[model samples]
Target chain A: MMAVARAKSRKADEANNPSSQVLRFGADKPLILEAGVKLAPFQIAYETYGELNADKSNAVLICHALTGDQYVASTNPVTGKPGWWEVLIGPGKIIDTNRFFVISPNVIGSCLGSTGPASTNPATGKPYGLDLPIITIRDMVRAQAMLVDHFGIDQLFCVIGGSMGGMQVLEWTSTYPDRVFSALPMATGTRHSAQNIAFYEAGRQAVMADPNWRGGKYIEAGVRPEKGLAVARMIAHITYLSEVALHRKFGRNLQDRQKLTFSFDADFQIESYLRHQGMTFVDRFDANSYLYLSRAMDYFDMAADHDGQLAAAFKNTKTRFCVVSFTSDWHFPTEESRALVHALNASGAPVSFVEIETDRGHDAFLLDEPELFSAIGGFVASAARAKGLA
Target chain B: MSVNSNPRIDLQVVADLIPDNAKVLDVGCSDGELLELLRNQKNIDGRGVEISQRGVNECVARGLSVIQGDADTDLVYYPDNSFDYALLSQTLQATRNPRAVLEHLLRIGEHAIVSFPNFGHWSVRTSLFFNGRMPVTKDLPYSWYDTPNIHFCTIRDFVVLCDEVGAKVEKAVAINANGQKMGFSMPWWFWNFFGQQAVFLLRR
Candidate 1:
């Protein structure tokens, strides 16, 4: 019964009640997307921890990655699991909720209580599906800026994130330089590379190729593209991991039987693990949302918007930046982060660049990496000192 | 401890040369001790380029602006005369091309301060003459096979390179084994024979 209910309301229900605090922007304050579409009656769902100081200068914005919601350091109502970034954000953790007011919002165009393709279009009184105007990283950040403005926070103490979230962080700095005192953009680049675009294209193709996708109207048809979305998730999941990590975790290990089945069954533990990953993802994520979000990432090119010089994007910016990359993260390799650091340097911005020694690939930022913790912890403490946060 | 024998004193000499509030870049800034010192004491805007990941991490932990980059390759990215002072301490010998690195330092900063161990010191010459093997001293700790100091030079050789690079020496100080600077009146041959290390302030 629970699975049936979850499957039925996979799209609209979450757009209404996604398990946390939500902010509703009426038609009077429509979000003007970069594509020149004004989205009215939009809502931004978010979660906050710690208390805002009397001066309101201690607020930190934590941007979520693709498919990550606002449940930064708590339980997820849909997944029944801990928050994605709970490892680094707790009372005494690296982010240290006790010290700073951390606000994590579900970015616009994502399906977790934020206005996305799954939400009702209001124009037709039905799910927007593919009708929703395509959202860019800048659009997502602009919505977040409105959310921050609602709190009367003139300047965020820091803005931090990894992967897609990291892209948002860069956008935040570029779009509103004075509003961000410092930024930590980890495991991401200033622009998505061709390889990354190819991977995302493959995922999008898998979802569209499914018969149940119904021309992206699956939610209205009462049938979800579970099989296609699962395949997409499986393909994307592989990119998030490295060959070393894969070898270390499931080195040709069989799943229950001693020998191969010689059939189309999940013979290897890796295959079984990927299938489980795919199935669980389909339960909480929207297929159209995935297509939209991946498309948004592919369109991210900060340099192109700034006269083709990456340094021009940060000309005379005062925000302090710390760019980090993992040694084994092939998805967003160390060279990408180096490019960002070089741009920041050329622009005469105060920046610190560190490439951590890790075998955990792009997901290392979300794992128990002591070096990463120390680097972030130390950086935050120093920035806090500089910001005069007691 | 004498200025030439103590690494800390070597950094102090380099630190003493720069004026307060100057924009400085420390190439090969290992762990950022000099940059931190300059930031705190001189109140200068400081940046660093360290080749080692471990060193870069340590610098970031201290809240110093640093990047994981080689002095040889990464220095070209900076625009000319971007910094008031460029410092190279105890690291010039390790660079693949010392002449090019020195030229870059001069080009990137209006003034460059460099300090290096003098290979023409009496002890290094005697060690090679008697033992006929590479010299191992308190300053140069590594054996010849494992040494990172690839290009060793004397005080006179450095002066000649400065001339070749078209850098005018504003100030030059040669320190002996006793941690004291040799007399300024002494000739280049005398300082080359007795001086353990040398520090020079250069400008184009």
Candidate 2:
């Protein structure tokens, strides 16, 4: 009877949200998640590029940041924009598609065809809403492990990501020390700072206060909390940029005019930019998924797992790490990355760090900056040669 | 077609000084040119510590073992006697602390080979005397303000410092800027008057 109800609930979700693309895999099959709650009949959405070698030693797993889906190098049907990291994941790009078998999965608690609040509950015949068990970054990694197993890959050549994606990269190395050969965690922290959590809380409050939220049951009512989600996106977007970048891009500039209109109509260029950002973001992302993912980030604390010693977390790791940060990124400053490097060095792990100079803020990792690209390109190439992958 | 075949490196000189099939570490190993020559031509196991990511990448791409690290900070990571020789050809003057770094290098490897531009060369002296400014010669291209060569020393100054620090000079080879051997039969004053660079093999 439980199986029948789960099938019915899945069918309802399918009717409401159509898949942008089919989920495909190789010979080995997906494993059931082991978080105690049986997502028995749950499915993961992922995309792959390049061919798997006969020895299967060339696979690289890319963990995506918050609001990123599995379509890494493909078109986002909703936004019609190129893949979030198309610059870094093509045929001859740094993470070369021709040489690496790459896999990127839509993380759990996301809206891109993954199990989340929008996913239906088997028992209630409705959305999970507030009923879904709270998940942590480690839980997301555990789910990804199931996907890794499905590919029959025992070890990954490298696990790469940035920002929230970087959190998953660190978790991969810590949780599965023997399974990762190299890790590239860029523009990220070992734990979210108190200030970051405060911003997340503000965004959550904005979404929850909306009348259309309907106590997290707006899905059944056919109502969308667009206004609150936009506000939340606007606030979070400010954190993604650096003060230097803001000053350089839009410093006291009037919006499409030489002078202010003397009214509250987004007269400043920065305000207009923020409004566009908020409006465009609401077109694709689910408000409830945003709340859940941010909460997951808030709960992440790598040092807590090692008896309050950050070095202890990496004591047994044999994985070579390349921890990168940007100089202008106040979000995850170079100090945080240096702390991770220091911890790795204290634990006797082979680690390297590069704090690249750039005004692109935290988003520098995603852009086509020549220096960052060259650094990553060079590091991966060197690691590949060391592993005999070249 | 190997990059090691460049005319700039004194292959025969470095070859005679470096023992065959020895563990070697080279600093400022630009493009892994010298390390590759040592590995393929001399049967030595070579590693390097380079500051430039591109240079380190090139080394690795050529199948060389090199770490991307600053010699200023990363040298302490290695244990004592980690290599048979630590080669710092034409790179010693560019380091942050030439004296202290040489001591560390000698402690890390059984022998250390250091080569640098002799600031007391006759052409430099002539240029400074006549022009009344820092000389921009063939070897040291940058002016005083922008030059990375912070610890420029004359051959006599380096020898005196080595003696003061109790470092034994195993072998010394003075060469002109074009990498030709200088005749040792001449007086020290005459040699210092003409020699452009000097390479020294030291042991503690």
Best of the candidates, DockQ: 1
DockQ of each: 0.80, 0.13
CAPRI tier for the interface of model 1: high
- Report the C-alpha lDDT of model 2 over A235-329, residue by residue, as the tens digit: 99898898899999999999888887889999998999999999888767888889989998888889987888898888778887777788889
Which candidate's lDDT is highest? 1
Two-chain complex of model 2, DockQ on C-alpha atoms against the true structure? 0.13
- Would you give me the overall lDDT of model 1? 0.90
lDDT value for model 2: 0.78
Clashes of each: 2, 0
| Candidate 1, residue A209: lDDT | 94
- Compared with the true structure, what per-residue lDDT tens digits does model 1 show for residues A1-390? 776766567446877667789999999999999999899999999999998999999999999999899998999888779988888998988888888999999999898899998888888988889999999999999999999999999999999999999999999998999999999999999889999999999999999999999999988788888899999999889989999999999999999999998998999999999999999998889999999999999999999999899988888888989999999998899999998998888888888999999888888888988898888887888889889996
Candidate 1 shows a clash count of 2
lDDT, candidate 1, residue B84?
97
Model 1 chain A: ten consecutive residues of lowest lDDT: A3-12
**Model 2: per-residue Cα lDDT at residue A332:** 88
